[model samples]
Target: MNSQFNFRFSALLILLVATLVTACKKGDNVVPSPDLGAQVAGTYTYSELKTGGKTYPASDTNLKGTIKLTRQTATTVAIQLAIVHKATNETFADDAAEDVEVVESGIGNIELHYNGDTIAKIKGTKISIEGEDDAGTLFTLFATK
Candidate 1:
């Protein structure tokens, strides 16, 4: 009876080990999340073009800037933006950090709100981002790494 019990226990142990091994196999349905920090850390040259408004002269509608993206965490980034009007050479600057939502492997979105309205909308990957701010004035940023 003792020998029979030992054989049954050994067989059960082997079956358990086999089940665990199968559960940990590589081809299982589990998938690893992509690393977001490594994909969006860089300095990008940006241009802000304003149009369709009577706020400024046509010559002053174009501006240039530089945007820097620093990774704050796996799901957050720090944005530094500076823009200068081409005609008047006036400068506008803004700095903020936001927690971004990943849209896919290489895409993300960040929205900045002022008084419940989304003043700035940021969407991009590591290579570039399209930023738009709509607060009294309209400006769109085209950024490239």
Candidate 2:
């Protein structure tokens, strides 16, 4: 190649590489969500557990309640729910189990899956949950600040 052609070619190659590198780099303008899933973790006072359309309030035995996000990853999440006695502050043994990889988030609503089936959708700060034992059972929980 001639000197001028070689110079032009080199410039073009540099420009192409620069363009590709910039494109691959994450954009600073793009901002991520305010961590709606993080809000899912924490303690919740037992209001009730809803089955189908009816809400069954917890008994005096089930006074204190706690929900925890054991693992929060890019594409996976693990959660746990526990009940405790208000007076004794003792956590219930049988109720403290984790839901490993319970939800994969995308777009706006996060689809929660348990035992190879969809449980509910979580969006923004509101969570829609259903008992895995029965799909018909549904409950809505608002994320507390």
TM-score list, all predictions: 0.53, 0.43
Regions more than 4 Å wrong, model 1: 1-21, 26-30, 47-50, 53-61, 98-135
List clashing residue pairs in candidate 2: none
| Global Cα lDDT for candidate 1 | 0.57
Local lDDT at 91 for model 2: 55
| Residue range 1-145, candidate 2, lDDT tens digits | 5999999999999999999888877686578755544644444445545555665555523354645454464444565555456678775422333353445466766665656776545565444444433344345432221
lDDT of each: 0.57, 0.53
TM-score of 1: 0.53
lDDT of 1 by residue, 21-110 (tens): 998895687776655554556776764343454333333556667777677666555667766666677776565555543233323664
| Candidate 1 least-lDDT 10 residues | 50-59
Query: What value does the lDDT take at residue 126 in candidate 1?
Result: 22
